[model samples]
Target: MKERVQKALDGIADLVWPRICAVGACSRAVDRPGRHICSGCYSTLPFYAPGGACRICGAPVAAKVSHLFTCETCTAAPPCYERTCSVLAYEGVAEELVKAFKYNRATWLAEDFAELAEGAVRAELDSHSVDVVVPVPLHPNRQRQRGYNQSALVARSLARRLNRRMDESSLVRIRDTPKQSLLGGSERRKNLKGAFSVVRPAFVRGRAILLLDDVTTTGSTLAAAAEPLRAAGAAHIWCATIARAASTS
Candidate 1:
């Protein structure tokens, strides 16, 4: 078939001309097919070590008490979502990749991000069945300016890899809130209050949803997004993020 021939040609070309790493400063040649980050650079990513994070929020804890270890903060006030699976700590290369994919229009990195997060996602999915994959929605104005929603792109790739249906329209950002990067956790929660609305309640009710996002700090954004879903009668909501910010305290 012509499609097969083109794929073969592309594979051959990759061997002949290695692709450059996605990291802006580290443009070294990568030999892996369909991978933009070189193995050496990839090794430097801040992958979360097993049992080092809170099971509930995926935040790094001093030491995990059990498989269901919940951090003190999460134990005090649980997030809207049932659980979170984070692939990397938001520092070093992980932070760089998220920023580039989110703000610089480096949409191609979505596949790479999805691949990195796939294992954690699968681990979570193994215990609970998710009926739909939903990306944290971006305000129309912000999405129009960026030309794409970074989370949606990654969610689409993840959905394909997991063989799940992706629903991007059910969740909508109704308010154009201030950037959360500059705000503290409480302030960020306030900013996102009433910002999200589930437009299609029928599609989500009684369905277990896998919510996707690029990065999570205090989890305010993911929690806010899940609030509307919870109100709409979503059976259960679980969140996945490429990276989670290192605990400040």
Candidate 2:
């Protein structure tokens, strides 16, 4: 049949062609099987130093506090989320990865981001026994415009990897706020006030929740999103992002 011939052609074409790296701006072929990024590009991606990161925001701590000390901003005014873990500093190839995943609708990159997030959050997850995995919700308008929620994609992958329940219905965004990156920190917080609410309080009430996102600029959005979860009697809130814009210590 014609269908069988087409299938055979497709398979032969795949075997003959080299797989290109998925990281945008990289032209290299994938170096390893079952991977999208070439090893060379992967090595170039910015990574956090892994030690002495702030427990509150995952920012690099100047002095080695071993997770005991707080960063200037976090100590001055703590966020609703109890812990934070960002696997990479948002620069270089990491920034490219974020843009590709977030703007280019690269859903496969979600799997890579999830793997990075798992390495960071595994220690906490093992100790805390997370009850649920929640992705920061996008406004209905934005979701419709994009045809999918990036956070939901990353969170769904994360939950599956963690073997925890993923709940998209429990949290809802009531307002379609302006992009967080366009405003100052204060403006970002104000822009997000009353923007999120819990429609299904029963799901989060008294449960430890892990929040996932691709990149965090100021973390104002995450803090705002956690307010509703806190009010709903969630016992703990933790955040894990693919990258943070701040410099590593």
Candidate 3:
């Protein structure tokens, strides 16, 4: 009885407040019912292909390799995370939707982003092997200023889809550093140095972790966040993101 009532109420609500497509430019009414993005917009979105990408960093390699190959950059100076998986290239529709979700308070887009990222994540990782999911933490001040941690929202939805435990409190950002977007790759790494701390090491100790983030540029933020997790004795760490910016090198 309650389910029926709730469904009816939701139906009425949708009629009163129709959902427009998530793409900023394409303000079309969503073609798929209950979906955030329209089919047309989603079809044009730039999804990432891992065929010629570096296994460790997900960066595109200039030359195709026969087998799983690490890029020269990753081979020279390895990141803390062993591998990375990302769904979309941070461009066009994907970029607009991410900005909306992160900066404009479109929290409902969390589930949509998670849904898009799930297939890529599952293809690259064994869902059964991931013991816990952890979202890259934002400093308390920043989180408060933003009203919510966008990464945490995505992580929760992803954890639900993966059927893994999510430790939102175990990893914390101790320092409120400058915006990573404004800094270069090397500067981004230095800005976040010693910014993260682990509060409950036991929670992630000896457990495989899937670190979730909204996007990846130089991967400095992900690398910095994983430092504390590695020190806390995490068995292994893999990074996943909704989008990845084009590699500069």
The TM-scores of all predictions, comma-separated, are: 0.91, 0.86, 0.92
Superposed by TM-score, candidate 1 places the C-alpha of residue 215 at a distance from the truth, in angstroms, of: 0.6
Q: Clashing residue pairs, candidate 2? A: none
Model 3 lDDT per residue over 70-97, tens place: 8888999998899999899998778888
Which portions of model 1 miss their true places by more than 4 Å? 1-6, 12-17, 125-128, 247-249
lDDT of 2 at 59: 70
Q: How high is the lDDT of residue 248 in model 3? A: 58
By the TM-score metric, which is better: model 1 or model 2?
Answer: 1
> Which parts of model 3 have CA positions greater than 4 angstroms off?
1-12
RMSD for all candidates, in order, please.
2.2, 4.7, 2.2
Give candidate 3's error at residue 143 in angstroms.
Answer: 0.5
Model 1 scores a C-alpha lDDT of: 0.85
lDDT of 2 by residue, 114-222 (tens): 7777777895544247888999999999999888888888788778778888899999999999887777877888999999999999988999999877678778888
Among all candidates shown, the one with the greatest TM-score: 3
**Candidate number with greatest lDDT:** 3
Question: Clash number for every model?
Answer: 0, 0, 0
